[model samples]
Target chain A: MAFVVGMLIKTAAVPIVVAVVVTWLLHRLERLKPHAATLGVACGFIAGWFFQEFSVWFPVRYLDWFPAAALILALLPRVSPITAAWLLVPAFPKMVPPRLWAVGLLTVSTYGLAWFLNKATDKIQQRVIVGVFMATGTACSLVLLQSFSLKFAQIAGLLTASLTAALLSANKPYGNAKGLPFLFIGLMCNLMFIGYANTSSDVPTWCFALPLVAPLVLLWNPGSKKLQAVRYALVVTILMVAVIPALLVHPPWEAEH
Target chain B: MSRNILIICAMALLLTGCNSEEATNPSPDAGDNTTPETSSGSGFAVTSENTKVLFVGTKKSGDSQAGGFKEVSGTIGVDGDKITSVNVVIQVDSLFSDQDKLTGHLKNEDFFSVKEFPELTFASSKVEGSGEVTITGELNMHGQTGEISFPATVSVTDGNVKLDAKFKVDRTKFGMNYTGQPDNPINAEVDIEILVNAE
Candidate 1:
């Protein structure tokens, strides 16, 4: 029991609890039914603030991406793509000097990918996109825990991914509308990882790109509908293959020793 | 819909405002210094060249690592051999650990967050004793301030005053609670030694 409690604290149970409560509340609001992505963003922002105000270990700037990404998703459906893309402009100045060019490249690439994913035709494509988002979020969380010894970031990532998954699951028959939230989260998570990589030592360059690229394996499209589950497993397996080794190379528990 | 977005934007701005001021560009000289006339009369400038503030923290394996500030400046007020007041400012950015990686990590958010809080300061509220010294003061660090007391040995020779002290401080008291790992954790209590020279 003592070890379990220790693990819970290490995993940042407090913030996760707050996030779950907030997400549940937002889900219950009848008025918010059409704006679930916006609700997720708001909840993410609150969770981030809760973490910071309480002096939890997650970097506040990185946590801020949750709301920022949600806002982008919320606006994508309401305005022109060009207008919605402007939402990320405020964060550019905070990037490290050497990372500015990379940020620009990432922004353009993510924007293009999000735009393309927004037009995904079938349920299988949408599911793949969602799976990709889930994998990236989990991978980044693990990376934070293993590479930088950032337990708070790891917990925050887990909470955000779980909340996103719950939200997506509850609102099934997703169709084309599902891509927006997944794309937003995927892009933001990737950006956060990149920003972290720029400042951190011992993080390999491949760790930065693997999550974003791993989802592309799903683009090959299995020939039959019956094989969709196998394809999903394959994509996740590839992502794990890419991410787990990186974590093994630099375990957070062994870092200080 | 627009109203909700506007509210969120406003909240974001408010949250941004709560961030601490950047620690990179600390004021070159921001602490109280006794004026030349004051020093000539009843006080002495604490010379940075001869003063040292060192700290030893225990790692998970119970081994100790010592680090210290390369720069510190302060003043000591005295009236006829009776110490009156003390003021000290330590540059957090000047902290150096045994290893370069540890030094960088200490400066980052995990330990000092020097980018957000660049200076640690102490100002004495009361000073007592003669041969031995007891200083009750406020120590400010990591955007938090708290009172602390430590005993010291004081000596005056050749028109110069010197103080030596050793004490333990809880890092969590100053909001630095980055204790790592459950099985092998960084010790919360850090041993600190202070040496001050004033002439």
Candidate 2:
């Protein structure tokens, strides 16, 4: 009962603090009205959720690619730069996950070229800008993985080969930390299965603190324009990389009651 | 105003003291143990051979579970009732799981960031035996250092020495927080179990 209260406190405390800080920043810089700021916060929250859940799929992750695809519409001088700017966020993590990177690069490049085209026409929509950038970045990443080959089969083959190599190397005891999360999940599934058959123990009180600190830091000081944008990207990147291993390496017995 | 600053400072100091390492077990029911001064009967000499240490921790809730930490390597020096010095190294990536893909990701940036900060280590400053062994040490993990204590039991029988301790570790100290699957995320309180044999 105490643990549950603590966890709720921890979870609520951080996000509330973050919302305050972010709200302050938007008001200070963008001079957005209170209502507009509220709307933006809601949008940001939704966007965060999208980044968390949907980005796993290539198409959703690469939504930023749509702006680039709108290059035809983005030919308008005002819109192209804004769409281009969003690219900086996703590109921060050099090694994004396999699915996200592949889809993102493909979609971003395709849309980016389109945006470049629209840049000549000047009919880009604000909504489409984020999407085009996502697509273009995803598309370009695919190209880079395939060493810029235009051939689709070659690109798919390269992706498969890369995945196979990563998996093969992961089977060994050591090499890179990237392989730990998968192992952790397997252990947890076994535990959960056992937990279903038997009993599971209560998690300790302090488990609630992990998510609280980092988000508070990011929200409070989104920092300079470059850093503010990069900060979110950085937080997301680190979490993306670390969560799986933390789970894989987790012991099965602890879950036992 | 300056008053707010002063209040903040005072609050910080209070927190520091609250989190500071205690000399012995936090429970009053536990025996009161202090560093012994004079030598008693024949001091139990740790067999200068065949001593090893084991550490275990678990994620508990969220995306992870519980298990023994496999890559623990450390040294124990005992002199009479006092443990003069103890140093230990835990490979954060050693937690085992069935799937290979997840383990690889555990070592990635979202988790241990093993490349950036690989080892979780502790060096004891003082050890005293009352009923249970109380060892206070400086623990270093994820680039942060803090003083912590582990309640332990020590015994010497035949030619072997055994040391056991159980405690908790917080992963937030190392800056690992990812929310994709919060239900099974890394548990902040990593239960640590240690067993050591001294030579």
Q: Highest lDDT: which candidate?
A: 1
> Compared with the true structure, what per-residue lDDT tens digits does model 1 show for residues A115-190?
4445442434444565566566667655544444353344445444434433443444343233354435444545
Give the poorly placed runs of model 2, Cα more than 4 Å off.
A1-129, A136-257, B1-64, B156-160, B177-187
The TM-score of predicted model 2 comes to 0.38
Q: List where candidate 1 sits over 4 angstroms from the true fold.
A: A1-126, A142-152, A160-255, B1-49, B58-66, B77-83, B98-105, B182-188, B197-199
What would the per-residue lDDT of candidate 2 be over residues B1-199, giving only the tens digit for each residue? 3563355345444543564222111111111222233233333222213333333334435344444445655555555554555666666556443443344335444455443345667767887774377899888775567788878887655444577777776666644444333454445566666766654
| Candidate number achieving the greatest TM-score relative to the actual structure | 1
DockQ (Cα-based) for each candidate: 0.09, 0.01
Best by DockQ: 1
Per-residue error (Å), model 1, residue A210: 7.7
As for candidate 1, its clashing pairs are none
Question: Superposing all C-alpha atoms, what RMSD in Å does each candidate have to the true structure?
Answer: 7.3, 20.4
Judge candidate 1 at residue B189 and give its lDDT. 90
> What DockQ does model 2 achieve?
0.01
